[model samples]
Target chain A: MPDRLLLAGLEIRAGERVLVRDGGFRVDAGEVVALVGASGSGKTLSARAVLGLPGPQPGVVAARCSVEANREVHEPWSGVSEAFATGRLARFRREVEARFRAIRGRIVGYLPQDARGALDPLWTVRRQVEEALALGRTPGRATDWLARSGFRDPASILPLYPHQLSGGMAQRVAIALALARGSRFLLADEPTSGLDPTVQAGILEEIRATSAEGVGILLITHDLRQVHRVAHRVVFMDTGRVVETLDAADMDRARSPEARALLASTARIAWRAFA
Target chain B: MRATLLAGSAVLWLVLLLGLAGPFLPYDVVTAVDPEAIGLAPSLDHWLGTDHLGRDVAWRLLMAPGAFVGPGLLAVAVATTLGVTAGALTGFVGGVLASTIRYLSTVTASIPRFVLVLLVMTIYGSEGWLLGVAAGVAWAPALAEAVHQRIEVLTRAEFVLAARAHGIGSARILLFHLLWVNGRRMVGRQALLLFGYLLVLETTLSYLGGFGVPEPEPSWGNMLAFEFGQHTANPWGLWAPAIAIWVTVLATGIVSEVFAEREHA
Candidate 1:
């Protein structure tokens, strides 16, 4: 199988502040890549840059950024570099919008950090999921996907707006909506941040099961426990740079000072719980 | 609840319509002064008694809704279109354009509405169209200011941003979605409020000798103005037209309040 996404030296900046410096990673088909970092560590920015959320800043340069998928090399997702060099950000924005429309619901799904904010308040849960499916599929197929997204009582949910739903239910609806697009890559930023531990585990299990079914996930989070539970590959970032990458199995044996420190802290916490 | 409110307003509106239409049909001539009926008081022949001019008070009351209601409705329509459109556009397209329009509307609104009406009457000569134009000019700025504020609130809503993100064109978003969906309430409320103001403005204009051509034509305000001197002799002469104005304004208020409540619900 081909790699779902390949990034080389992806750089991001916000005005004069260099938020993400020379970040590069790839998720092969059917892989879950957990990007673990502390808060303000550019993990979210990297994900946002990949998803083409905010346009890039001036004077930001990307040395060798390229994204390849399905054996076709897409134009460099270097929004900042283009803004600085060509001053054609408006044209570039149109191109990005067009590209996003084509690929977002078809090949890439984005799970924003705030699940409530991700959903429209006025629309019912099922309608939101239906909208996501409609973006990429035939009407009949979209209905089928909505049904399969764990909505057994789709009729009831279809009429119940977002405010009426529980937080966990809302997050599930967000996930279903994202998945309904039939996207191959899921960029989930803190998929279970505000949920209780039990709900978080349940959500993580769903994410893991979904990833097993040919979905490549770039999981942006700060939870080390979650990293241990579901990550197939680990990319540790610090201060806007990808400092280390390791197999999930070999994460304990990693020697980079930052990685070792993270592992050691997590180990102490685990041991303390047992003790 | 909504249905009940709407039904009640509909009934009130039906009554107003009947009053307006009652004059055009074969009824006692409103301005037919019967000298023989002078000081005759309410009787079988004159249901609401005769004015000092010996005109049937009932006929005058019946004719009152027609003269004012047509012009009021017309003024409301013109003012609403101009006001809401200008307001929605200015508010949605913020910055220099919005500020300039806002400033202009403020200046217009700041001037006494009666002063503006007098100015318009001076220029346009108190014909029915001029009456409507005068009332509309006086009313538009207030309605526009209201619509502008409402649009400003809706422009910041998430759905609008989402619509933009969907690559929907600005014009479609403003017209098909924003204007009707979010703006209907403000416009409806303004129309009702303006209806009351329209009555008062028309009455004021007539009192100042601005409405109707010469003798046959009669306005409720003109009748009231004529009867003001006769208050001690026959208060009903003044009271009849005064009551007409009061009922119309009250009906307008009730209908508008019901509409606003339903919209919020």
Candidate 2:
């Protein structure tokens, strides 16, 4: 009934080993949902599964996956491997890839980790943003998106390439590129991980602002503080599963050992900041 | 590196200029042979002396650049097109298709290039352009392997993954972003090296006679062939084309080196 992005019953396997099992989350329009966990806790893998990105290994498969966006449902991986069975792996991959391609960037944008390095080095910032706009067929200026991403002098930033941008600036440009697509949903993976505290706050503010504009966002990060800063709901993952789900404000009330440990780590840093 | 690059470029440009001007020069390899000037040493009247056939060696030497460069460019073009296409496809489309493409390239590359070119030329009738085509076909597999390997690595790069996340089509990403942006230096270096190889192959074939730039065409190879058995007191006729091939090939190596250095930088 509501405009939302949902992935449920998802399982990602790399060869014989399962990387993510039974990972599920939902993000309603205008809400910021954070997938939080420690490193190698399947946070990134789960998010990447949602995008249908291939795993690092050759035999990687995302099975039992179900995704619903804007009320249209797709069980892209369900019965996919079984139906093909053998001798048609390429066809199976193509069909699933096409399904995801139809929604990516146009309906669901992504801001990857290492946002600065993710930018095309050969292109200027303006051109990259404009390309996203053109691909999404969204009617807006690159300057408008840049401004929305917190660049005050969008004109000055436009001509600069990725190499010319500082970490904070490149992160902003990456955000602008994701936002320029005018997608109903966005997935940001560790958007402010390497940024200084001040720049981190600025980037989080941009995420909050985008959510306010009625775009549902799934913010993936290990930092619980970032979740509290911008997210409405937090899905805490451990190993390969969603171990806990709690309101961002209720992080202190977390019951799962994994979520509690994360909370304690964040508290130690917060106390250190005060001391 | 900068000095070498500059010097190489200058030499290449001079060769290109002379090659371009060779056709319009007064001394013609076919028609302007003089009965009296046979094997004359380098003098005020003739620069680079005269060949055994009484033709000015300087004019024939000028002709070799166009012969080598024109075919070398064609070879590079063909090789780059085949290599990049095969590589991009192999990288982008994984699974059995990728394996098959890689296998085919390996098989193609395994064949000796010189022998393959010789066979193709023998079948197609020996022409300089045919040499370019055969050499390009033979050399392309190496470039394809390089491109495929590069694409395999680059497809996993943050920039490429980010582009994919943004819903850019695979073809555009492969061509514009992968090959053009990240892989251009690799392509350029390989292409330049292939060009040099093609030049040497052409010269070797032409020198061996029968199936190359035949007769009065004045390719560096055939010129060497003509001057080799001569009893001329002047050795410039032989030295001129040999030195030109050496210098031109060295220049190409220099350019390729520059591309490799820039890539590392």
Candidate 3:
């Protein structure tokens, strides 16, 4: 009911094989909700569905992909998709897709899993951020966005191409571009996956600060430690479905066997590092 | 490599000047076919000597470029635009459309392009524009396949995926990112190769006669075919167009290579 992003009853299918079944989650304003799962758990697919993105394979239908934002509800396939004729469904999809396009970037921005690879190799940092700003019609300079993402000297960073930047720097530039859209919510997918711990902590801190500024974040990651650090709530997924949703403080109390196993694995890794 | 590129480019420029401006040159290839001056060796009155028709070989040689250059440009433009667009679009929006394009391209590609061009010229007549268009259509399938393959490989690249995820529209992605950014080298290379191919094709058809650039048009093909037997009388007629074709094709190839090298560097 609060200003939030909601996705429910989402089903993604490639032909007859189901990828994600009945995936659902919510992130209210100023809250960080981490969607955590092992590799191949369909976390990214479900997140992409809210924006009406089809999978790489054709006929990867995303049905009942419902998005709620700014108190308006948008369903890509209203009611039962199977109930409508092909023509009617196609028309309905077009209508919803337009709305999804409008919501994307402006209302909800997406951060790709690979930060360095995701930044356009040909584009300068300034150009990339400016494009995002231009697309959202957000009035601001690239330097401001870069500064907000933690760059000390944004002008120096502006002229540099993606390859010139270190991995952490590229990630910050990506974050700047994502935030430059004036996005109210962000879908950060594995934002800190390949960074050193110091840089990881810095990025987590940036995410926390962004949340503090009232941006609802749906963080998709495999790191339970990251969930403990910045998330208000955690959604545990296995295979393709959400298995558990629990408060960050109560992750230790999660009862799902998959959740406990994941916790145990993280715990063992942490113990080995300390030992 | 540098010297080859420079020499090729210089020769290319002179050839293009002759081909494009041949009609306006101060010599009459059409009405100057004097029977008295037939097969005259190179002299101050007639540069490069007189051909079997008694027309100045230099004038006819200059006019010859128009036969291939114009049609070659047309073919490259048509083929690159059609081929790149179809290939990139289908590859970007995969599934049924991609499969259909691939299937169609495969079928079209199996038939030799020269054969198809021969059929088109036979049916449509040997007009330059018609030949250009026919050759463009004949060549588009191959260019399309190359572009499609490039797009398929880069379609999943993280930058492309990120652009989509950020809500950038398909047109901008295809135009700016795919074509302009990542695809310029390949497109440029393909366009150059297409133009070279078209030049050769046009020349070959004209040389074959009847179904190519008609008589009095002064194509390198027909000139070579007509004057090669008379090389003993005047060698320049045979050498002029032959050297022109060689220089043009070599220049295009070298230019394409240089462009690719610069892009990589």
Return the top candidate by DockQ. 2
**Candidates 1 and 2: which is better by lDDT?**
2
lDDT of 1 by residue, B19-127 (tens): 4685564444776778777644677887778788888777776666566677777888889888987898787887788788778888888889878877877886777
* Preferred candidate (DockQ higher): 1 or 2: 2
Kindly list the per-residue Cα lDDT of model 2 for residues B1-265, writing each as its tens digit: 7898999989878876766676676544543778888999999878889988788888788777767677777888889989888888898778898788789988888889888898898888987678788888898898888988888988888988888888887889988888887789989999888877877887898899998777777788999988997888889989998998999889989988998886765
The DockQ scores of all candidates, in the order shown, are 0.21, 0.59, 0.51
Query: What's the lDDT for residue A258 in model 1?
Result: 79
C-alpha lDDT of residue A80 in model 3: 36
Q: Model 3 segments beyond 4 Å from truth?
A: A11-22, A55-88, A120-126, A153-165, B1-17, B29-56, B92-107, B154-157, B213-217, B231-235, B259-265
Model 1, position A61, has a per-residue lDDT of 45
**Worst 10 contiguous positions by lDDT, candidate 3 chain A:** A55-64
User: On residues A60-138, what C-alpha lDDT tens digit does candidate 3 reach at each position?
Assistant: 4444455556677656545435535344555455565676677777678888878889987767888899899998788
Give one digit per residue, the lDDT tens place, for model 2 in A44-73: 877776677762224445555554556676
Candidate 3 chain B weakest ten by summed lDDT: B22-31
